[model samples]
Target: MWQFFHKLGSPKWFYGIATRFMPWLLASGLLLLVAGIVWGLAFAPKDYLQGNSYRIIFIHVPAAFLAQSIYIMMAFSAVVTLVWRMKLADVFVKAVAPVGLVFTFLSLFTGAVWGKPTWGTWWVWDARLTSMLILLFLYGGVIALDRAINDEKSAARAVAVLVLVGVVNIPIIKYSVDWWNTLHQPATFKLTEKPSMAVEMWVPLVLAILGLYLLFGWLACLRMKTEILIREQRTRWVRDLVLAGGK
Candidate 1:
């Protein structure tokens, strides 16, 4: 296990592995996403209460879940980079930041759209919503800090520290609906309790979540490959690869 972990820190190894996996990832991600969209948008029953507006949850919940999940992943990568000085870990941090931010923004946008019909207000200062907004800011901060720094290593360290510190917001975001009397509904899918949703309703939601996760993985790998190419442009193999591609 330790050997596997240490080996993963190597850029050449990770790059090779990532390249090998890219096709499968892309194919699977697209397949799942299409399936989810069809199931959610076409077959799923409309909400008895919110009617068609509730359909937005297919996109909204998955995005919201990914928003928080990717941040935690970024923070974990930060810890790995800081403790082990793994260049691949730094690459992961850089690769995931923009994706995380986009997902966070999607979540917020969908939430507001859903709010208009449900809450009769498009915006609110609710705890869950506010914390999620802050999460978006944190992702932006990481991306900006990384770009602003001149030295790559220095930038990685700085962003890593910021990510580690900002992680405290995650749990706050997770439990905010329960912690305070907020307009936001409590978690819909729970492991502890049987899902409150009917099978028709919940199946599509599950598929959407799985599809979003696969999409995130696919995008992350693409971004990481780009970063690797940029950083390794001067290397013999990279130069050879480019020259070969041009032939």
Candidate 2:
């Protein structure tokens, strides 16, 4: 296990391994996303209350899920950096921050779009929405901090501390609906309880979530590989790989 963990910290090893999986991840993710969009938009029954506008959840839910999930992943990477002093850990944080930021923005944007019809307003300061907005700012903070420091080690340590502190906001966002009366509805999907939605309504959502998760992995790997190349540019192995690939 230690050996495996150590290998994961090796940028060269991960880069080589990741290159082999990209094609499969890309193909599967794209296919699942297309299938989910089609099923949710065209075939799923219209909501009795909100009608077709609710279909936006198919996209919003997945993006929101990804937005939240990627932060937890980043937090874990931060821990790895602090405990194990793994260089790859910070690379993961660096590569993932921008992608996570985009997803966070997408979730907020889609939520507002979904809200205009359902809540009769385009914006609100509800707990969940507000917490998510803060989450986006956290991502931006990490990115800004990373860019501000010249020394990579110093920058990484600072970002890791910031990420660790921001993790407290995640559970607040998750449970905000329960903790306070709010315009945003409670979770439609729950682990401890049967989903509030019918099977037809939920199946496509599951697909969208799965597809988005897979795509996130692919995107993270793509970005990490680029970082590896940039960080390892002066190394002989990177030069050799480039030369070999050029032949």
Question: Which candidate number would show the highest TM-score if scored against the true structure?
Answer: 2
Q: How many residue pairs clash in each candidate?
A: 0, 0
For model 1, what is the error of residue 238's alpha carbon versus the real structure, in angstroms, after optimal superposition? 2.1
Judge candidate 2 at residue 206 and give its lDDT. 88
lDDT of each: 0.90, 0.92
Best by lDDT: 2
Q: Estimate each model's TM-score.
A: 0.96, 0.98
Give the per-residue lDDT digits (tens) of candidate 1, residues 112-151. Answer: 9999999999989999999999999999999999999999
* Alpha-carbon runs more than 4 Å astray in model 2: none
What are the clashing pairs of model 2?
Answer: none
Error of 1 at 56 (Å): 0.3
Candidate 1: C-alpha lDDT: 0.90
